[model samples]
Target: MTLDFSVVTDVWQSLVYGTLGTLFLAVAGMIIATIIGVLGVAILRTHMVIPSFLVTAFVEVIRNTPFLVQIYFIFFALPLAGVRLNPTMTAVLALGLNGGAYAIEIIRGGVESIPKGQTEAGLALGLHNHEVFRMIVLKPALRAIYPSLSSQFILLTLTTAICTSISAYELTSVGQRIEAETFRSFETYFTLTGIYLVISMVTMWTLAAIGRRAFNYPQR
Candidate 1:
């Protein structure tokens, strides 16, 4: 079998566009996931039984269910409830909700690691609830969990490929179009593998830099 890379050369522009699309989805989804995670933790800390129980239930359901099914439900079933969204929106929403579940647990562990005295100290200093959360609990917890969150974000970035099932304009959807035209199955997928690796590497580097800036702590 003659492996031809000329197929990749011909579809290079499409691939580039797809990479940009994937990056957009990944970054946007990461932002949404982070917001959900932080907010979820805040609600759980309130110790209000009903709200805490609901948040716990949301996390548990998302964590237990398959991501593919979650995406499908958001894209298809949500419309029946009048929540119509384009594939891109649906994919971003699903990715955020899915990642947020894990983020909640990761961030919660970080929070739990901190001694309760710090929180009590902050309260005694006359800090408001949100202030204590933002200043005392959240920042350090995020620092502690940064590596895990970075890994999860990278996985979320790769998961963008799955958005192709809904015709989202991401890397995999673009690759499928190119593959259909080129019929170089092995070559096409081989090229895609390389591209995905590069994207993951770049994402990892970016996350590392952000962590260094945001979570820099003196090593004891």
Candidate 2:
């Protein structure tokens, strides 16, 4: 068969739309993951209540298990418990929870890396505990962990392909659909691999730029 640039034009719109879906899944999950990471680490550090133990167990289990199993549990088991989430929601929840578990360790390491003297200095300055954490600790800690956190988010974006098992129809799912329709499995998947590589590289570069801008302050 002759090479067809024509096929690229034909499929460009579908690829763009599929990428949008993938971005939706990735960005939504990243937001939830950030919330969970912040709260989970805070709870673990503070040990507020029984929920702290639950969060500890939750983080451990999510970190240890495959995200595919987590997705299956969210999609399969929740309905049995009379709580049904849509496919996209299930994908986002699974990805978010999994990413959050990993992020907890990254953030915790960042937080713990702050010298005890720093915290003491903040206390001496008469800053409240929360204010100290917010002002003196968080930015430095994040600067330390930004690379790992950004990698986790980019990986989570690639893993959005797994949502196709439940019919979420993000990028990979759309590629599969196109391959089925056009009987161009090799070409379709090859194009998808290229697409994913481009997107992931762009994401990583953007994150690095953001990190540099945000964390460029002089260190003591």
Candidate 3:
């Protein structure tokens, strides 16, 4: 019944390695999701009815489904269709797609919040449609939604723990292995909980600093 943290000392390296794996998965997924989000927004904004419909459908399907199920499908089902992927890749793809669905809506809201006159003004200035989007709209929209986007990414980082379900070898998976070895379930999980909190706080603070640098401006 005595509490012992000596087990942690023994397994600290493994836990640290696992945390780095978790960070890698989260960061890779975030990059993929951001790319997908930008593309999804572009597709949705297009005048083409079919592409817009398809993008909307993709967003709806991903947003409505449970992330675990999506991961299972990516890990379990895709291989059956001859589209095999490694556990890490599967985890990244699943997490990215899941996050992308939410990001689309977030980015779309940012885009929509800008006054229509801004778009018109950009077009009137002899800019191409893409240039107008990039120069006149995208930056401001991103600045407006940067906080929400950062929060989503933080959630994405936490969601990396679920990657362990697919044996993706993230922090939670390593913690489970350590717990199995040490039989110190309480101490192991408590430490993991604390580590996750630290990760979350660090991520938030880092994003806030990036936001200040990227989005700071004089408000009228």
Tens-digit lDDT string for candidate 1 (1-220):
9988999888799999999999999999999999999999999999999999999999999999988999999999989999999999999999999989998999999888888998999999999989999988888888889999999999999999999999999989988987899888898898999999999999999999989998777743
The residue pairs found clashing in candidate 2 are: none
Q: Whole-model Cα lDDT per candidate?
A: 0.92, 0.87, 0.91
How far is each candidate from the true structure, as Cα RMSD in Å? Answer: 1.1, 1.7, 1.0
Candidate 3 or 1, higher lDDT:
1
lDDT of 1 at 34: 93
The regions of model 2 sitting more than 4 angstroms off are 1-8
**Candidate 3: worst-modelled 10 consecutive residues by lDDT:** 211-220
TM-score against native, each model: 0.97, 0.93, 0.97
Name model 3 segments beyond 4 Å from true.
none
Candidate 2 TM-score over all chains jointly: 0.93
Q: Per-residue CA lDDT of candidate 2, range 82-159, in tens? A: 989999889888888888888888898899999989989999999998888878887889988999999999999998
RMSD of 2: 1.7
lDDT of 3 by residue, 115-208 (tens): 9999999999899999988767888999999999999999999999998999998999999998998899999999999999999999899999
Candidate 3 Cα lDDT to native: 0.91
